[model samples]
Target: TYITFPIYSGITFNNISSYVGIQAGIAASGKRDNTITTSINGIASSENQLGNLSILLPDFGIRAGLILKLSNKLNLHAKYYQGLINIFDKETSLSDFTWRTQQFTVGIRFSIRNTNDCGTCPAWRT
Candidate 1:
């Protein structure tokens, strides 16, 4: 999941718009199943553990993305994120790890305020 704060918007051409923003969010890794087998004096035993094979946990990251407005309500978005905190638990592993991600999405936006209302319009709305 993520949240974005658009800081700027520009009219690239007639009926075309571009936006830039900062995003922050949390991400998680998929769970995995691992097994270990041991043998002693011709006897064998097996053990299984079901969970993440790595040390990744719920992680926080910052992101930046570009939104290309296809229409008044439709846009294409692409973003890159870098982890702000290492997801690796020191107690679990000795290696340092970080989580990073990239996203591409298409979405729709709605505005409650009228476009013609300029009383409280942001500078990017010009």
Candidate 2:
């Protein structure tokens, strides 16, 4: 499990908007379930479970995406995330290889009211 905080900036061109951002996160907990099987003198087999995995706590990533305004109250968005740090904390035979995260997400957003149509609001005045 992990939690992340993202900072994003967006610009709209006509009906489409583009965004780019950076994110930082931490892995709160990490675990793995493993099954180990062994044979003693080829007589019998035994099984055991290995638990808990060591994970690098800090995560850093970059995000870029686009949003299409389908309507005044609806929008479609897609984003790509690339992790800059390796989350794998284990050492292996291959010292030059590391694990990173790559993800692509697509979703829709709905708004009760379009903010652009609100004009000036008395409640928002400082």
lDDT of each: 0.55, 0.82
- Model 2 over residues 1-126: C-alpha lDDT tens digits? 768888999998999999899988887777677777776888766566767765576889998999999898899999998999988776633355587878899999999777677666565556
- List residue ranges in candidate 2 displaced over 4 A: 43-50, 91-97, 119-126
What's the TM-score of every candidate structure?
A: 0.48, 0.79
Pairs in steric clash, model 2: none
State the displacement of the C-alpha of residue 119, model 2, in Å, after optimal TM-score superposition: 4.9
Model 2 residue 40 distance off true place after TM-score fit, in angstroms: 2.0
Residue 114 error, candidate 2, Å: 3.0
Q: Please give the lDDT score for candidate 2.
A: 0.82
Of candidate 2, the 10-residue stretch with the lowest lDDT total is 88-97
List, residue by residue over 5-117, the lDDT tens digit for candidate 1.
33443445555555454544443345667788999999999999887645444555554555565554455665555556655566675666644544555555554554446
